[model samples]
Target: MPRSRLVFWLFFAPVLLWLLLLIVLPHLDLLTMSFRGENDYGEMGWTLQNYRNFFTEPVYWLTFVRTALYALITTFITFLLAMPVAFYISKLARSRVRGALMILLLLPFWVSELVRVYGWMILLRESGVLNFVMLKLGLIDKPVEMLYNDAAMIMGLVYTSMLFMIVPLVSVMESLDDSLIEAAHDLGAGKIAIWRTIILPHCKPGITSGAIVVFMLALGNYLTPNLMGGKNSLWFTEQIYNQFIASFNWNQGSAFGFLLLALSSLIIWAGLKLTGQRLGEVAS
Candidate 1:
């Protein structure tokens, strides 16, 4: 047994080491880099200026808060919409059609999110498909500006994150016993009562997990907001990208990245605490 345990650890050790080297080491490097950096003349020194700049800059803080709020709104909307769809997939779908429907639901995953977002762009932009359709319908003589707005940003986020929310919800819901729901119904529980009392409590882990994933992705997103929201959106991750790529302020960029990491960790912890859950249980 001791020899077997040693062999097992030896096998696992390289994988752990690889993870530490690639992921953990890079993060540590980023933390160090955020504190210490070079000047234009290539002189290096440690400084707190990155954090100072982020806090002191109004646009940086505003974009960060805006991104957080946008992600929150998207997560909430995804939960509201995904629950019923997941339930339908789990409870209402027949075996004959279920496979087909599941495939159809997941077909979008095969398409790139960038492509999907661009499709939305074409549809929402002025003088684009939507405007053309409205013009033909005589709804208005002029095309309304639809893109580069908060609504556009939220729509893009929801579209991007919906699959993440739906898949986990469906996975968790599919395993739930129909008899439990029947028992609730037999106990004179209405649809709302059954949903509130029986369904919500059971799927808390999936909801929590899905929320963390979607929220984290959205909060750190630079692409979707930039493409869909245009100049008006001003997402926080974009600010970090600007710092690193445009301004060549690697220290400030690293600081923003670490700030995002800290915020994401806090959100994940709060979600776990709120749901009183473990992902292992949910997956099992």
Candidate 2:
């Protein structure tokens, strides 16, 4: 074989193997499991009952819709928060300041996600630091319960998902020409006009990519919603977890997982369509 061909195989082999073994094969297994069920004779056979249950059951479908909505909201919120920070680091800050700001953003991720969620709990719980400070400052009559609710869950989701949104935005925004902004300003464009016409158009790909990733992460997240929202967290992933871990219903869990995969894909497709972004461009 040619040297170049051999070198190409050497580099490609690991990635191919990793995709086949870790992604494709596992998904295939789940697909099969999702269609399998036991009949009245107690014999396992192919059936659509697992998928059907998701629709026939109100709790299952309602939770699925609710999770999707929350994930979308979290993605939008994360984008809103990350955009200004990314713009500062990419366009406004000096190199030294940018590096320091990036480090600050990344510092929390050095800890495990579980640890970070617990940190939020420490800050947000009724008897936690936030309440103590509020009470001391006479800001409240009593310790306000801040944890175990949708707002808390959304906060935790945004915190965890913020870095993903910022990194992509920063990467794309760094390539934007400062001259474009200066020229627009010289032509009497205001801040909002500059952002609307120049910056936003330039960052479309990054925004689409980051939004897709954040949405998927928020959709599939178990720890943040489970811990922060507590018993009230009616997330779809929680239902999937209950099916697999608590009830030992792998078929049902697999079905739920596939439904989640479908939901994410559909939402992302719709978003890209609405934004006039092709997946290829976003991926690049």
Candidate 3:
């Protein structure tokens, strides 16, 4: 057999088996559990009641709708902000400067998410640094309550998800030929026209792919929303967590997990369509 085939068998086969044992099998088990109904001692009785609760429960659907809207808005905002940063770093920054800047962009991932979220908690609190600074600067007489709200959750989401959006966009943008933009300029096209007619078309895949990744993550995140979203913002993942760990309702938790999985699939599918993926690309 070929060396490549030998390597695949040696390396990839074990990983494939591990995935089957761990991820795929567990996910399948969850699917089975989702079809069951709640029972005494937190056990499942095979029925469709768990799935029925998702649609019929007003609170469940409300949380779902709210989470979806937040995710969509977060994804769009992250893309809009990250695009210029990625394009600039790829096209304009010097090689050494790019390394430093990229590190700055990715530096937060070095810390735990809990730590980062708590850091935001300190910053956005009434007696926090922002309030003190604004007051000292005579911008405001009193501290604004920036903590414990949807706006705070959005800030946290944007901060955490920015790098995911930036990296993919940069990966595609760095490969772009600068001469094409120059050629457009040479043809007497204005800056806006060149960006709209040329650069936008070339970077569509990166934009779509990055936004999808960010959106899925933001939608499913429990930490940021629960910590920053406060009592007012009812994120759906918190419900899943409560059902599984707090209340020990495994059936309901599984149903919630399946709903999240379905939502993620829909968003990813839409992204693939918008990005114009080929058949082979989708398959592989």
Candidate 4:
């Protein structure tokens, strides 16, 4: 073989193999399992029963919709919070200050996500740190029940997903020309007008990419909802976990998994259509 061809294969072969073996093969197996149902003989038989179950069962369908809505909300919240931080780091701050800010943002992630969720639990649980401090300050007569609720779950989701949104926003915003903003200002364009016309359009790709990633993460997150919201967290992922682990229903779990895959893919496609951005451009 030619030297160039040899080098190309050497670099790309492992990636190709990894994609095929780990991602493609497992998903293919899951796809098959999702369509299979148990027969009278207790053997797997091809059928649409698994998918039908999802539609007919009110709890399952409701949980799925609720999970999607929460994920959407989390993505929006992350985007709102990240934009200003990204703007400051990329456009306003000095280089040293930007670096320090980035380090501070990233430092917490060095700890395991589970550890971070537990840290939230420690602070928010009744009789925990927050309540202790508040009580000591005479703010409340009793400890507040802060954990095991929707608010706590949303807090964890936002905290964990912020970096995903911030990185992409910073990447796109850093490339924006300062001269354009100055020119807009001189032309009597206000901050809102400049943001809508210039900054948002320029950052469309990054916004789409980040929102897609964060939405998917929030949708599929099992640990944060389970740990933070306790038993009341009616997340779709928890249903999947229950099917696979608690109920030992692999076929049902696989069906739920594929539904999540479809949900993420459909939402991403719709977002790209609405924003007039191509998948390749956003991915890059």
Highest lDDT model number: 2
Superior by lDDT: candidate 1 or candidate 3: 3
Q: Which stretches of candidate 3 lie over 4 Å from their true place?
A: 1-13, 38-44, 278-284
For candidate 2, what is the TM-score? Answer: 0.93
lDDT of 1 by residue, 1-284 (tens): 35687788998999999999999999999999889876577888888878888899998888888888888999999889989999888889898788888899999868998899989989999968999999999999999989988898888888888988999898889878899999989989999998888888888778888888889888988778898886867988888888899999888899999988888878877887777876566445
Native-to-model Cα distance after best TM-score fit, residue 104 in candidate 2, in Å: 1.6
> Model 4 residue 72 lDDT?
95
Clashes of each: 0, 0, 0, 0
In the range 149-200, model 3's lDDT, one tens digit per residue, is 8889998998888888899889889888999999999999998998899888
- RMSD of candidate 4 to the truth, in angstroms, is 1.9
By descending TM-score, how would the candidates be arranged?
Answer: 4, 2, 1, 3
Task: Give the Å shift of residue 16 in candidate 2.
Answer: 3.5
**3 or 4, greater by TM-score:** 4
TM-scores of all models? Answer: 0.92, 0.93, 0.91, 0.93
How high a TM-score does candidate 3 get? Answer: 0.91
Off by over 4 Å in 4: 1-13
* lDDT by residue for model 2 (211-271), tens: 9989989998999999999686699989999999999999999999999988888989998
The parts of candidate 1 lying over 4 Å away from their true place are: 1-10, 37-43, 279-284
